[model samples]
Target: MKQTGIPLAAPSNPNHSRSLSVGQSIRHSFARYRGVVVALSLGTLLSGCGVINNMMYKTTGDVMQGFSREHTIPYLMESGDLAMGCAMSEATAPLLMSFGRVTDEPDQLAVMLYLSAGGCAEDQGREHELAALAAMYERKGNAAEDAMIRQKRAYALASKRYLKSWQHHNTYYGESGTGECPDFDDDLDEFIYLAGLLSGLQALNAEIQSTSSIGVPKNVGSIVARASSCLENDKWWGAPMALKATVWAMIPGAQPEGEDAFDRLAMTDRLGEEAGVRLSHVFHAIAATNKGDEAMVKSVVRRHAESLKEQPANAEWAFVDAMATNIIVSISDRLWVENTGHRTPLGQLGSFWDDQQKEVETMDLDGLL
Candidate 1:
């Protein structure tokens, strides 16, 4: 056999050595990614052998859609462009759904599409929320009369998108433990099921924040409380605890006897810190912000900032890593935009509050941010 491709060579400049190293690194990553793609394609072909495959195209469609959702989505989100990300999701979701046309378990594909669609909507909703907050700041600075109107419109759109996210989640994971949804196995399947619950709750929170028109229903609280029990200690770190704490904090008189919302939040915060995934901190900060508890918000933000400084997010789960950054950065962005007319300070994204101790002054614009 003869080698045909270009031969590898060292760079002349030692400084340019990093370029070769980076290219090699990319090659290794692509090798692994290609293996996954090859495996899926092989599996798809192996399953499409005869009448059996014809009868079970549902399984085939599921495998293909899963690949699309898993591979395409994270890249779109990691691009750091929300409008483009949402647009990509909108375009890809229907392609995944089209796979369901030949499947018996059509709703299975719908569940996945709805979940992905909900996430897409959430990205748009957060963009709207940030814009609304910016508009509110403009009004505070004595802007034109239309500033208030723009703020209101932005909030309305944010609320509408969040409502859509919640509705999509509800369609699949209907009121936990109700036996109304599809069956799921343990391990990753269970984790995904729980994630749906978390997604629905998150959307509801956003909706309430933007419009104040929605209330935490008692039934939903009960469902989340019940669902939290299924999450084991090792599987989700503090996610289940975070969910419980969020429910307790949001619903009026929902906390159990001898337990407080802050206490639960603190415990979840510790767990998230240990796990090196600080989603609980985001939940805590948001809940505290809603309560107008500035101290608690700062506490959560500072702790999360410190943790992120200690260790950057793991790249193995880059979607979650990006999400953690997005949430924490949003907190910093809120503070900076309100105080200095900017987003997170340069190079101080995760450690903004802790390192700089930048105090966000209180403004008189209804505390919207």
Candidate 2:
């Protein structure tokens, strides 16, 4: 049964309660949860009007739908705690999937569930990539002769997880070169779909970086170009621009006529900062790493570090923001392990060996003892 007397969109006045008001709301709650309402009413009354209003709002379907936009999706995007977010998403997968059972393919709930599942897979892929980095470090050390083998295994796993992420995207939105637009509920859903496309490309990039045996796909450049064309630069906090700039920087001659890769990358950096996402910096840093341009890498890293210091709080699109930081940190961590036989310095995550003042440093000796 659909609940009425609730506004589908936000009420024009913040203080305006719906037509149901408190008495009707109480009756509706009583009807839905009779005994349960009686037990909860005492505590709710003690908590004041705010709590009671919240309880009433939640009883309505419209409010519940709004809850997904304001709370559920934002939490998915902006959460700082990666482990907890992954666990929660995994736990809710069944419920999210259940929504799809009753809803059509183009339904909002279906899109949300698929986007969230894609995120879960992306997180798992990052974990596998981290494992690969650890194994790469082991290969650099003297004691681990099997590290190369382990690194290869981890990279393979990461690639698979990324593929899983994209598969979620393909389930509803279809794949690239399909010659169609996904029938999304709105702009937000379309943004999420495009983000999934980027996630898949990121997985391919990771695999290519990890091993020379697996070559980059010839069609990858066209895929990036097509993905970049779907959305305006402003959508989803300039994510599309970031994707476009990253491709230009990474793929030689990919930049459009009269436009340089450096200029496009610079524009992405500005857009990311304006949007408070800073994901473009992450992409730029990775591209620099791929090119072995140590100077460019250091420049990107320093700017990223400064940006983080300025806006440490990720109040919006938290997941994307954190993922960007995670990638940049991994890049620095690898550089540190390769040079100093240790991870990046405590709290100095993005700084690398090039920042060191001297080539030689003091070492502990048995003679000193």
Candidate 3:
């Protein structure tokens, strides 16, 4: 009943995606992540290709065992970094929800990276290496000294504090200007932009506390201020996508309330070009408001809706869906030339996401997003 928690998304028919046997998907996933697969290849050959997620990473590894391909993925020697990167990748995956197998793990590996890296069986999202370091110092170091005990206690406290802060860290970033915004910067987590936001916040808090006498509070005031200015001025970098919806509403002769949130952003030309498809959503939004133009509205909405339907199921993201939905409502989406806005959503106005347009168009963005 619930697909990825987005009520609006049309559930994807398996037909939209190429259905492969477990072996096939595994082979494809393994091929792309060959470095990880090579470690497990021996097992694949020995076990007749049954090994997948279970063997690749297990609860505990045989540290003494030498390259047990049948039981383990050959150590990437790089999984440490891979783990961290994957964590970030997954966190950001929500933005580009359906890209590929990369995000398909549902950020599981990413979360595992945090758990593994944090070295927690319970998954508090701490960096495991940091935990191991404290353990090493606490038990191996001179336990005979009082300072040593105090030192260990301090480390324990620091770790706890870092963990607590992360639990409360903000992950909700506003993406739509149609609703209320909290002083414009309340949602920006620059430290953890995309996936690593909380971890980033946790890391920063830990680093500062580890290095300083008193823990410095997370100060995002300046960053948040700058982010708001960027939005007001249409600076897309480090900017929240929520403002994008407002921008879409601003096309002339479009929705009347759309202009309510319009702030003249600088570099309008570039931003317009970058968000052409998203901007197309503004036209779609306006089309929804046009009463007499039912035929044109339906045509525009259907065309954009079709594009949404055709959006890559693997790559269809939240913004992509929202933009597609927004675009269908835009009046310009239905117009050819004379009635369109000065800046068309992206280049032409139909569909966008350059990486998309090709492999994605056929996937049914509507069903996928």
lDDT of 3 by residue, 1-369 (tens): 645865575647765445546668888887799976776886668675444544443322322121222122223212333334335433532332232232222221232234223322112222333333344444534432443344344434444444433333332343212234334332222212222222333343344334444342344322332233334334332123323322233334322354432232222322433433333333333424433544544444445545544443212123323433433433343242223212235544453223245354555679867
lDDT of each: 0.62, 0.64, 0.35
- After superposition of all CA atoms, the RMSD between model 2 and the true structure is 19.6
lDDT of 2 by residue, 207-288 (tens): 7645633343556545756766667776665667667767776777776788766667777887777667888887788767
Over 1-369, each residue of candidate 1 has an lDDT whose tens digit, in order, gives 788787588567877878878999999999989989999998887877765766667777777766654655444434545445446546765765666576533333344344445556555555555555666666644443344445444444444443444454456555564644455664545555665566556546545545556444426655766577767644565778778878888788878899887888888777777766677787788779878886677677778778877865544443554565577677767776666655677767644443556588977887775
Q: What is the lDDT of residue 33 in candidate 3?
A: 90
> Stretches of candidate 1 above 4 Å error?
1-63, 66-88, 105-116, 135-184, 210-218, 350-369
RMSD for each model, in Å, please? 23.0, 19.6, 33.6
Give candidate 3's error at residue 333 in angstroms: 14
In model 2, what lDDT does residue 272 have? Answer: 79
Candidate 3 matches the true fold with a TM-score of 0.21
Query: Candidate 1 — which pairs collide?
Result: none
Per-candidate TM-scores read 0.65, 0.64, 0.21
Candidate 2 local distance difference test against the native: 0.64
In candidate 1 the C-alpha lDDT for residue 121 amounts to 51
